[model samples]
Target chain A: MRTLFAAISGGLFGTGLMLSGMTDTRKVQGWLDVFGNWDPTLAFVMGGAILPMAVAWALTRDRSPLLGGSFPAAPDPRLGHNLVVGSVLFGMGWGLVGLCPGPAMASLSYGGPSVWIFTLAMLGGMLLAPGVRTRLDVMASAA
Target chain B: MPMDWIYGLAGGLLIGLAAAVFLLANGRIMGASGIIGGLVDGTGRSNAAERLAFLGGLVGVPMVIALLMGFVPDGAVTANPLLLGAAGLLVGVGTRLANGCTSGHGVCGISRLSLRGIVATCFYIAAGGLTVVLFRHVLGVI
Candidate 1:
């Protein structure tokens, strides 16, 4: 049942990515290209997504999930180095490729070898990140 | 008033609704990187099946849609292999290090008013814009 729900959600999410033009690298880069031809469609996508999500959070506030597990607790509010630095790096990559995780997955069917290369590289990075993060944490503590 | 914006908005709503369902049904955040990352990194062995299921749907449903609709979604990924590899590595490491991606932080976190989510979103967007300015405008390498 849990798995089924997850699959349903993932399907919906992918469909949304396709319809929103997120699957298009050109469109995504255009949005980020503030100095060049800027595209504002993504702004609407962001805004539209936030509306229902805000309400979902509200609904979840007092109610438990239908499934057995508990809702995720509030995240730590501190602006940690991991959050900032990782995001900056992620952003740079996003700018370079105009493909974030969700759209990257959505595009796999027709995205060809380039998509495969990017996905494999991204997976390799994911595999390496934990070690790098641990090293960074140690460095931070030592300094 | 462009059709693309309308499509974007409608798609955004669907994405939000997907998040809501995931939250309401499973009580978990629907973060793509986190889900896939956990699987690759071996930290999420307990819920591996669940993760794979989500991923399967994420990958599968679109194929079905494209087949039935007869329109392939264009990703327009860069043909440059080096750029693609570099970007992929950065995205992979960065998302794992940060513990979320655009879906997790941008939509779900911001909607919930989580400070981490908001901060992450701001920094990433700023960084992405700067990269575009540097690479596309100044360097023109990518």
Candidate 2:
């Protein structure tokens, strides 16, 4: 049941990405290109997505998931160096290639070899992040 | 308003609905990076099947749709191997480090008014725009 729901969710998410033109790298870059030919389509997409999710969050406040596990706990409000630095790096990648993780995966079928190369490199980076994070934490503590 | 805006909004709604379903049914945040990243890093070994199932659906559904529709989904990415690889690496490390990406932070976190999410989103978007200025306008590399 959990797996089924997951697949369904994933499918919907992917379909959404394709429909919203997010799977297109140029569109993504257009959106980020504020100075160039700025495309506001992504803004609509973001706003549209937020409305439903905000309602979902509200609904979760008073009840548990229909499934056995608990809903995700509230995120910490504190700002951290990891959050800021990591996001900047992620943004640079997004601006460069116009693909985030979700779109990257969604585009794999039609994205051809370029997508594969990017995905593999991304996986390699993911594998390396933990060690880097640990080192950063150590350095911060020592400082 | 261009038709693309409508498509984008409709698609965004569906994406949100997907996240809602995942949260309500599975009790997990629908974070693409965290889900796949967990598997990559071995932190999600306990629920690897679920993660794979989610990913399979994410990749499979779109492929199947494109096949049936007889139209390719718009997936134009940079052909530059060096740029693609570097971008991929940065996205991978950055998302893992931040513990979220567009879906996780931009959608889910922001919806819930998560401070970390909002802040991260702001930083990333700002950084992305700046990077674009540098790469596209200043350097002419991308």
Candidate 3:
């Protein structure tokens, strides 16, 4: 039942990403191109997504989740070095190719060689990150 | 003419609904990077099946939709392979390190009023914005 719900959610999310034109790298790049021909469509997408999610948070604030387990704890707000460095790196990559994991995976059917290569490389990077994170953690504690 | 904003809004709503569903039904945040990362790093071994199920749906549904609708975006195919690979690597590493992405941080986090999510979103977007300026306007490399 849980897995089924997860699949349904993932399917819906992927469909949403496709329908929103987020699969279009050019459009995503255009949105980020503030000084150039800035497209405001992604903003609308973000705004629309936030409304229901906000309501969901409000509705589920006090109760345990409907399916069974306790709701996730609130995210920690500490200013960590990993967070800053990672975000900056991610941003540069996003700028280079407007393919984040969600969109990249969703576009696989049609995305050809470039997408394949990107996905493979992304997985490699993911595989390597744990080691890097451990080192960063050690450095952080030492400082 | 493309109903760009309308599509974006409608799609965004669906995305939110998906997030809400995952949260309500599974008691988990619908973060792609985190979900996939956990699997990769063996951090989510306990919930491996659930994560795979979610991803299967994420990719499977789109495959069917694209097949049925013949919806293929042409612009994505032309990217330089090397750059594409490099970008993917950065995204994978960065999202894991940061612990969220657009869906998790931008939508779920902000909606839940999580300061970490908000801060992460702001910084990544700002960095993304700066990257664009440097690449497109100043360097003209991309």
Candidate 4:
């Protein structure tokens, strides 16, 4: 039951991404290209997304969600160095290629060479995450 | 160009619905990077079946939709393989390091009114905007 719901949710999310023009790297890039011909499509997408999600958050409060697992606690609010630096790095990459993981993975079937290369490298990077975290931990300890 | 507001809204709604379902039914955040990242880094072993199912649907449904509806992404992608690879590396590493991405932080986090989500979103969007200015406007390399 959990897996079925997960698959359904994933499918809907992918469909939404494709429908919202998010799958197009050009559209995403245009949104980021503020000085250039900025397209406001993404704004609509964001607004549309927030509506129902906001409702869900409100309704789910004070009750156990339908699935059995406990609701995830609110994320830590600390404005730490890792969060800042990591986000900037993510943004730079997003700006450069205009392909985040969601769209990149969704469009993989037809993304050809470029998408394939990006996906492979992205996986390689994920694989290296432990090492990076270990190094960060070491630095913190030394400091 | 007319901003396809209708499509955007419809798509966005569907996305929200999906997130809501994942939250309501599974009690999990629908973060793509986190979902996939956890699988790779071994933090998600307990939920491997669920994660795999979600990914299977994520990748599979899009392919089916593309075939049935003839929908293809309208954006042009980078032609240079090296640049594409580098960008991919950054996104993968950064999302994992930060522990969220557009869907997780931008959608779920913000809806819950989490400060970290809002701040992270602001930082990344600003950084992305600045990068475009540098690369597209100043350098003209992209």
List lDDT for all candidates, in order: 0.90, 0.91, 0.86, 0.86
TM-score of candidate 4 against the unseen true structure = 0.96
Q: Can you list the residue pairs that collide in candidate 3?
A: none
* Each candidate: RMSD: 1.3, 1.3, 1.4, 1.5
**lDDT ranking from best candidate downward:** 2, 1, 4, 3
Give the top-scoring candidate (lDDT).
Answer: 2
Residue A18 deviation, candidate 4, in Å? 0.1
Q: What is the lDDT of residue A3 in candidate 1?
A: 96
Candidate 4 C-alpha lDDT tens digits along A14-111: 88998898888888889999999998888888889888999998878887779797888867878776677778888889999898888888888766
Q: Candidate 4 lDDT, tens digit per residue, B92-133?
A: 888888888889888888889888888889988998889888
Could you tell me how far off, in angstroms, the CA of residue A127 lies in candidate 3 after the best superposition?
Answer: 1.1
Candidate 3 stretches greater than 4 Å from native: none
Interface RMSD of each: 1.1, 1.2, 1.2, 1.4
How much is the lDDT of residue B32 in candidate 1? 93
> What DockQ does each candidate score versus the true complex, computed on alpha carbons?
0.82, 0.82, 0.79, 0.75
Give the fraction of reference interface contacts each candidate recovers.
0.86, 0.87, 0.80, 0.76
- For model 2, the stretches where C-alpha displacement exceeds 4 angstroms are B72-75
Off by over 4 Å in 1: B72-75
Candidate 2 reaches a DockQ of 0.82
- What's the true lDDT of residue B112 in model 3? 86
CAPRI quality band, candidate 1: high
